[model samples]
Target: MWKGLIKTNRQKEFFKKAERIAEEACKHLTKTDREASFSYETLKVIKDVKYPSMSLAKSEGGEGLSLYELLLMQEKIAEGDGAAALSIGWHMGIMMELSQEQLWDKAAYDRLVKQVVTDQKVVNRAATEPATGSPTRGGVPETKAVKQGDQYRLNGRKSFTSMAEHLDFYIVSAYVEDKDTVGWFLIDRHQAGLSIDKTWDTLGMRGTASDDLVMNDVKVNEGDLVELKSEGKPNAKGWLLHIPACYLGIAVAARNDAIAFAKDFQPNSLNTPIAEVAHIQDKIGEMEWKLMQAHSFLYSTAKKWDEEPEQRGLMGSELAAVKLAVTNTANEVVDLAMRIAGGRGLSKKYPFEKYYRDVRAGLHNPPMDDAVIAMLAKQAISKD
Candidate 1:
């Protein structure tokens, strides 16, 4: 489906490298999930491979990969380890956005990019708060950044901060008390009042280490602020394709495992393996169909985003549609795989149980299904 997606030799090389890293990471995925721990070893491999900086421009000391290429890399990594892919996707996507739009103060963003290039430091946005669930709903943040001479004192708690323990810098959202506007504050992890609370125990994607970030009057320089529009309308976020891609990878893994099991398992009651069974073949066929649909939608949307820059400004609905379709189909595919595997799927000895749980996390990711449907509905009504 993505024959010409990697147009250049450099892109092909990068994709091949990503696949190797993914194969290596897959070796430890079960242990990582079982322990519900962050894969520091896997992260070291990713850093060594420079996967996080792949989307940064060559001028910015990166590989200068396009959004579609980045998504392909993310899918490969998720095939190895979903939690690891999700965690790193945050860093890669943020870097892409910063490089493309130059959203923050140039000096500050330059310093951050230097760290990522030279030290492979990871960063993620800490915007979700205890008071406000999803920042996309347009709620005033309880986190406050008060101007104090040449610095600002930030005080608030952010929850569900993915890769909390590994982040070198956190892009925190807070209400500027003096300006009465919401803005993003760049806070270093080693700052005096910043701390991470160990609170990331979940049913799936446990390796993400999503914890609570507490900021108690942390002092930050004036340069650390990134101001946003008062209306809170976000720019077209093509990088969100990584979310569905990650889930799709997980579904693919699950489907492959089920097929392999069906081809080998034999019982005395049957002369042949389960693969020859009519019902088993039907279930596998359904899984393949769903996976193919998701794959086509995801890659087509990504290709469009890469080929037509002008169309991106109007692609918010299309992007959300891809997310909705891919994530929903991935979930269905995983379910079918589990059904095909039967009791063995639920057994901890097999990875299918973990895949089942991890795929469900896609439902809660950004551009949620309900929100996507509402956006599509609004667009249709307005067009009519």
Candidate 2:
């Protein structure tokens, strides 16, 4: 069995819970992947454990886990089921961001946090749109919110709303007509005009339920408007490290399966197991080296985010670089594992195919590789 990086009792407890959740969630992966359906059972387990609220401050009735801890948990969960990890990662990241930054309206956010902690409800931001592309690209939203007496009527569609099947509250982004700027509105799931479009068919991470959110004149309280769009570059988001952590977990899964196959399988032409073959040993060595590099890059960066508060604001490039490097390294590790396992790796009897597909999805997530590289390039070439 592959060893984990956990060192302390606190992380040990969290890793155990995450491992249990992953084991339970893995049972449904084949069915979900084949049918492109979601597993509500997996979500029930997560909510029962209150995994989403673990990042909240201790004063706010949460475990107050650090970024490194949360990322470690996220990685562990992804080892069993990437889709489940990806879906829950959004909720965990959102909760952490809210508690750490207090970027939303105080009263409204406090009420929402109460509901989240007590009711075990989950929240995720609905920001991407069909026309505007990714929100990270600085595109103005096509969704519009018009003020009407003590209410704001929102009518537009949000794409890639992950965890849509179970999201209790969607922090939706829209153009506030009165304010002439984009703002985030905390829209309730039970709102009259809100509906899910269920159009999340994809090659990988299909179980994320990243469908479209359709709002037709949905009304929200005036105070539900949580945050307005800010000018200039956004702050460094250390919580997004969960994205690379997930892919790394998938890579670890692939490596484990390949090692097992190499140890057990023996061809008639060879008296010994393939694990003893020189070329096979080479592949395993490369996989281990890459995994070590990825693990170091991800955990060290997350530890910095947790222990050094004063430097976080200036870590935007470094944080994105972690995502770019770890995710790409994960992609390589999965591919190498597939090679070691041979053609059978692609068969449904094995899981390398799934890991291969799922790891690629991280490239499409926010703070895309091209964007991160461009930011780094400009930072290097410009005058200090």
Candidate 3:
């Protein structure tokens, strides 16, 4: 197992801490999902552990952990509670990106990192506009950031702003009037003209608090603008592995539940538990097979990204393939687990229904299945 590969004592300690925190988070997941509310308690636990700062530089008040370690921690958190993992994953990813790329202005970025380290501030990129859909689709954002004398007035609405109410900062993407280019502006939650509509009623991931963010001329400093490279090509980001890790954790939870239920569940007519049933065993085996395949791909890609930084530039296709495979397999595993549990899976008494819904959300995450396939095809054809 990858855990055995963790040689350093610091890494092992961090992994143990993550496991403990995840267990605590799992205790509240039922109530968290039932209310369809953000898991503030879980967030508090994560904050107490300072998990968000795991990826920042040691000089920047972080543990200076590798990307692989961060993904492992995220998977553990997702096993306990998928919503909490998804919400915190944004903060961790953003911090990691800022730590490595230094894309944002130094002073502003430093301040944000300080806030994350000291106050446990939560932040996420609010880039998905209602008109533009996913930014990956290359739609021009309608969100405008008009330049003032020393500030930019940001105006427009953003959708799927996960952890909306709990965020201290939002890395908002908007069309800049002066540059005629789309850029990211860091906006604080307390800033005037910024409000959440609480319109996040969704089929799954209800606890993500993915509400609509309405910005009515929100004001931010000129320095708040994050600089972008002239080239528009997307860079390989290992942080995205957190997405697949979350779904895989949820699938693991579902599989464990199904196995336990099967071992104990006995029908009135049947002399043995459902574990003795061939059909039930078949479903469990299938789920295990899918999980193993997904885990191998996810960890191997993460390890490669960590060990071979120079090769990251050419990993776009491989990264997309991992995301597609892991997410799709997670959904399949959860479905099989549900099947093993029979009608109980559909009942509110079990967690399979929630896992099913949450795992499906991964299909809509970045590197959409259709786009991944197209990219793979383009790469293959070009090579030939």
TM per candidate:
0.96, 0.97, 0.96
Residue 208 of model 1 has an lDDT of 86
lDDT of 1 at 327: 90
Candidate 2 lDDT: 0.90
Q: For residues 149-267, what per-residue lDDT tens digits would candidate 1 score against the true structure?
A: 99999999999899898889999999998888889988889999999888778999988889899999899998888755456566789998989989988888888889999999897
Error of 1 at 148 (Å): 1.3
Looking at model 1, residue 198 earns an lDDT score of 85
Task: Write one digit per residue (lDDT tens) for candidate 3, span 176-227.
Answer: 9899988888888999999998788788888888999999979898888876
- Deviation of model 2 at 248, angstroms: 0.4
- Tens digit per residue, CA lDDT, model 2, 1-384: 235578889998998889988988899998888766668888889988888789999899789989999988999999989888988898899899999889987899899889888988899999999999999888999999999999999999999988886899999999999999999999889989999998888999987878999999899989999899878677889999999999999999999988999999999999999999999999999999999999998998888888999999999999999999999999999999999989998898989999999999999987899999999999999946
| lDDT score for residue 339 of model 1 | 89
Arranged by TM-score with the best first, the candidates are: 2, 3, 1
| Order of models, best lDDT first | 2, 1, 3
- Index of the highest-lDDT prediction: 2
Segments of candidate 2 deviating more than 4 angstroms: 1-4
